[model samples]
Target: MSHVNAALTPRARLKIGRLIVEQGWSVARAAERFDVSWPTANRWAQRYRECGPAGMTDRSSRPHHQPTKTPQPTVRKIVHLRWKQRLGPVAIADKVGVAASTVHAVLTRCRLNRLSHVDRATGEPIRRYEHDHPGSMLHVDVKKLGNVPDGGGWRYVGRQQGNKNRSDTSGKAGNSHHNPKMGTAFVHTVIDDCSRVAYAEIHDDETALTAVAVLRNAVAWFAARGVTTERVLSDNGSCYKSHLWRDTCAELGIVHKRTRPYRPQTNGKIERFHRTLAQGWAFRRFYNSETVRRKALPAWLHEYNHHRPHTAIGKIPPISRLTNVPGQYN
Candidate 1:
């Protein structure tokens, strides 16, 4: 295929060559007719004489030989350091006795520029896979965020004021005079593997009962959008391992799968979604109180499901995957 900036396509170059060679037209005249330079016209004509139509196609822009290229052994060393030691370009360069730029270039060629793209156990590129259909699998996890104190936290308010607010909110409970601190908000999340459609809810606890309820609701939410929950993947958290969660999954007919211990990448989808949730909703703006922040979740969730572009799903909103969903356009 011709490049975007190319003056002549393969077919046009062939015609120009025919005009100059077969028809005995002057090189300058063929160049003028084709709106190309005389040298361009003459080059194509010569190529036709030597190699015929195949030579009309674009040639490789790469040089035939690169004398200054790094040696293969040095490149292997850089890749080994990256995979085995998990070193950056500079570190690999220092160990391999090459310039950092050369190390970077070699790593880029080997697709190891980003450490996240390489597996920690092996130096190979991480193999990415997705389910064939929506609801074939769901990734579930909980992101624990510090509850915002009343009158805002240290993020927007000064540290002194934030501390005062925290102290003021830490009230004594019952007969005991011990002050209870403002606890965490557990953001329960469930995301479809294929479509990346996500459902989340903010709760005060990460108990097994809460996890079961959240999963049930998430399944219903997906069902409303024409996606049936077939399986659920989660970390080996206490809530996920509870009998309640097991019974609920059995009742819902969903196979409950758990990630290997200390291996978060096994359930990477929900883990990544938590990062997005924190950036786009939990900490996107300052709230005067926890109540205000809690109220903001539904609106952001709606935007995420129906409007926000998901990179995993072709930069379209997650709702686009559910064709049978009603009022999806709306």
Candidate 2:
């Protein structure tokens, strides 16, 4: 049956008719060989006599008229709204009073709705991404910054304000003999797993109080930009395990997760951030003094969050890539 249907095509019908005439094969034999009905073979032969090979050509299978179809004007409107106004199919459908699916189909057919995405935080254009909806998991983690030079030999730009009585002297002690002001500052940091937007701060200590403060600061920073801290992963450090940190998470209604003992890679977001920070900011240039390095931290962080383009987040800045802004980080 299938073979007979295929033989009805113009090319096959024309070939079969020609073979029947040339080989002088009977209609029944020709029909049997070609696997076509006898009537079909006879009709094809007659068509060949009257109109030659052209008459044996197959006709289109599509119906001549489409009674229930989207109007041409509506399709044109869909394409125009998508292209000129940059409206998505759903929005366009709402405005034009049509089914969203219909608008999508029309826009797809016109190939006019495929617009590139732009990172909202960084204000940079981004390639199209597959994960366009919400409820997608985004991870976060913090890293303690290592003692290193800031950049451009700016290690000692800012004044060191310690205990009023404390002082330092290179030869021995600058002002106070009991306490020196030089030490490694911990960098409290967080990173988004999906967008790779990192929030980091340098602090004189990594105590539980400082950890809570940094986490609060990071939350506020992300909140201002509309990125939510869905879940935060961290190491099992004393500061991270502190009650203050736990209370802060509870207050913010965020989940605080810790990595396995001796396995920092389990919270790799901030780990990767630490590596980038070291390479891009810490080791990017030389520094003259720790004060200068500490002072330059904020500017470096700003650059990292707002100016430095990321390869993973469609080359967009972290601020541009964030989407939700439910409430203030406060």
Which of the numbered candidates is closest to the native, going by highest TM-score? 1
Q: After superposition, how far is residue 113 of candidate 2 from its true place, in Å?
A: 40
TM-score of 2: 0.47
| Tens-digit per-residue lDDT, 1-330, candidate 1 | 887988999999999989888999999999999899989999999999988998988778999999999989888888888888899888887788889999999989998899888887666678888987788899999999988887888888888988777777644232354434778899999999988888988898999999999999999988887788899999999999999999999999999988899988888888888888989988899898888999999999889989999888789998787763454412
Write down the worst ten-residue block by lDDT for model 2. Answer: 128-137
Q: Which is the leading candidate under lDDT?
A: 1
lDDT of each: 0.87, 0.65
**Shift of residue 64 alpha carbon in model 1, Å:** 2.7
Q: Across residues 250-321, which tens digit of lDDT does each residue of candidate 2 receive?
A: 998788877788765456556667888877776566555456666777788889878888876677776565
C-alpha-based local distance difference test score of model 1? 0.87
Error of 1 at 298 (Å): 0.9
Q: How many residue pairs collide in each prediction?
A: 0, 21
